[model samples]
Target: MVRYFDAELETMPWTDVLAWQAERTATFVRGLVDRSPFHTEKLAGVGVPTGVVRDLAFLEDLPFTTKAEVRESQSTRDPALPLGRHQAVPRGAIHQVLSSSGTTGQPVLYGLTATDVEMWADVIATAFWTAGVRPDDIAGHLVGLPGVAGGLPYADGFRRIGAGLAWIGGWPTERVVELMISLGVDAVLATSSFGTYLTDRCEDLVGIPAKDIGVRKMLGGGEPGLGQPEIRQKIVEGWGLDVLSEIMGLGDVLACLWAECEDGGGMHFCGQRAVAVELVDPATGEPRAWEEGVRGEAVYTTFAREATPALRYRSRDHVLVTATSCACGRTSPRIRCVGRTDDMLIYKGMNVFPSSLRDVVLQGFADDVQPSIRVWKDGSDQVRFDGPIPMDVEASDDLAPDRYREVAAAIAADVRARLQVRVAVTVVAPGSMPRTAYKTPLVHVRETDDDQ
Candidate 1:
């Protein structure tokens, strides 16, 4: 049987959903103009009328909010001004302040009121429930420490859903494995990279195979692996998990805003009423229709928020949209992230995502290759690369040196044929690349040529 945390909201018709979103968005914008000085100035500067926004078309008139703008908002330090003029509520009303992971650059700050926190939990819990996690299950939360955006919100979500939660932050892989065994954890919440890493090291750390550990579900996010078919299969086979659901969100916007259903289709938009999602052509910045198989960059706007409300925020995440109704009965549009614009590499007029390259390699050479990969470049500042880009592929530990070389050559040839990009693959021993408790950096550019 299909289960949903909030069936009435999740299964609402498209017309009613849009009506709810429109009403909530207008109210939020009016409150922003009245309470948030930063937004007040921005809206006035843009010549937006000081009234309820009846038409959603008026949102297009407002300037798109960028990460750079949010970062700049933190420059002022006056006590009355607070961290940023983005806060619509007084400081005392804010229940918590969270920071972005800062993987790409400087971390931005986000404040949440009591209501905002409750909404966040509700959305996250709904996502978890859709992904097949239940209240009776014991889940091991494996993510970064509390200060960053990834871990704490999931913990809160699990608690809100009345699940038995184990706080396993900062625990080593061996310790995590041990806890799973001892506690018989039914589900694990972790980044895709960490989940793959744990699966790779599971047999060595513990006496049994990773699949034997008996984790029924792996809830993965914070990166692209779970959405990719080959990578998802690897996790499913390696960990012996029944389902692998990819929950996606941006730290600047919200966590776990979209989640895959048990049917293994694309991730459903869990932020339907609270967040407005749009797609735009990355190259031309023109709005794209949300038709089936359409590809574009994702932009978000908060329909109702008190602290740090965003207006048409550009997410920079390129995605393929599917308007087909999901078998799970959620009417929200589904999306599969193609790649992030920031991480894209343009080569000879073709854009290549590093995750796509990794996925192709994994699909072709699952047995010979390890999940660890690094796309090495000579300079730190370079975004585009010519033919024959350097990459390090980790070979399985059991493979002999001669076999490793052959597998590496074959991988390079396969990637060239499939992705149409030249790659110089160097097969390294197991554990050659660094592993993290959080998201893994697929591309590593050297600071100096001498280092290469």
Candidate 2:
């Protein structure tokens, strides 16, 4: 337990890591069911025995907690009451508070103690180190807000390495370029797409060539583009950078910060905290084959997550998990996040993923154009996809009114040839659809105000 953050975990003999995990699993399980009412009720409902679950096979003995279950707990449960006397901490012990996005509905709030934040910073720093993140570099941040959990711990990772950073919170493209040149930023903590876009566009606006702007490192989450190999390579080469590492993280669960190495197989998740990566079939809850090519839902578990522990936590992401040792020598379990289960659709008998179509379309489009996606409901059980068209190319081209038709035709042709399903494509004018300053909206369609 004391060696949790030690880098040796990455290279530890399989025998040792498993033994350590098994030893801690029982104690960790006891703490959750004993203290947190949320988990107590959940564990009981799911038929988790009151006794310790000692074996990895017994992990299946516990019922899985879905996102809906967590949301329901947040909605109905008051976390502060603490069983009258046996509280984990006195109410005033909380050092910080964070809120969920609330885009879907009401925001869920959480309290983080000082110890939790330290553990967060330390574990993630180790993750950055595993990906060859160094203390000598300078970093630029594109994180949006305090509550979003995007940037602070990332910056904290850099800071732990004794690196300096330009805290340029998510801003306009023009502002980012201006600061990049002014500050001579070397590394970026941003979305892979935005990082690529800035690299492609910075030469003209920043005075410094995008490749020479000194930007090298990229750390991002909240999207799947970082896991795309071709897109990852394009971003790295486009910037003339050697390192294009992608770290997987979650706001609610901070301990899953894993970094993708140059091999690009799957990211080595942070074991500094007790994160267990389980690949499973979303429907049957049966374990999926964790081979190189097969994809499955990423079920992540962590005992070291003291603030909010998640057991058998389903990430909603479909990923490729390879437990095999990497050629690069790191032995930590790694995952290639393929796509979100929610984002995949079976349309006209074609198994389609927005990310799958996205990786192809973004590769084909010109530099300045942005892509969009729309899913139309079909007969209550189906969701058909539309558009991977670049905004300006399809909407502002010389063809004018012929633009949308041309785009739809072109997409249908591509789909027929590659995907075998014809999808309608509609392109909006550049910036015709809007997004909040901090976030990018990938799915948008022509919907009337009355449609809501």
- lDDT by residue for model 2 over 222-282, one digit each (tens)? 5677666556666777787777777777655673377876676668767535566667887
Q: State residue 86's C-alpha deviation in candidate 2, in Å.
A: 14
Top candidate on TM-score is: 1
Candidate 1 per-residue lDDT, tens place, 1-452, comes to 44888888799976577666776776666666778777777778565545544446556666788888888887777575465877778788878788887866888888877888788888889889988788888998887478566677788889988899987768777788788878889898888887777666677777787888879898888888776676787789988888889888875777778888988768888887578877788877778877789999888888766677888899989888866578889888788888897788777777898988888888887788786579986676667777787889988777788887799889989988898888889998878778775778899977765665
RMSD of each: 2.7, 5.0
Total clashing residue pairs per candidate? 0, 0
Q: What lDDT, from 0 to 1, does candidate 2 have?
A: 0.62
> TM-scores, in order shown?
0.91, 0.81
Position 50, candidate 2: lDDT: 47
Q: Provide the lowest-lDDT 10-residue window in model 1.
A: 47-56
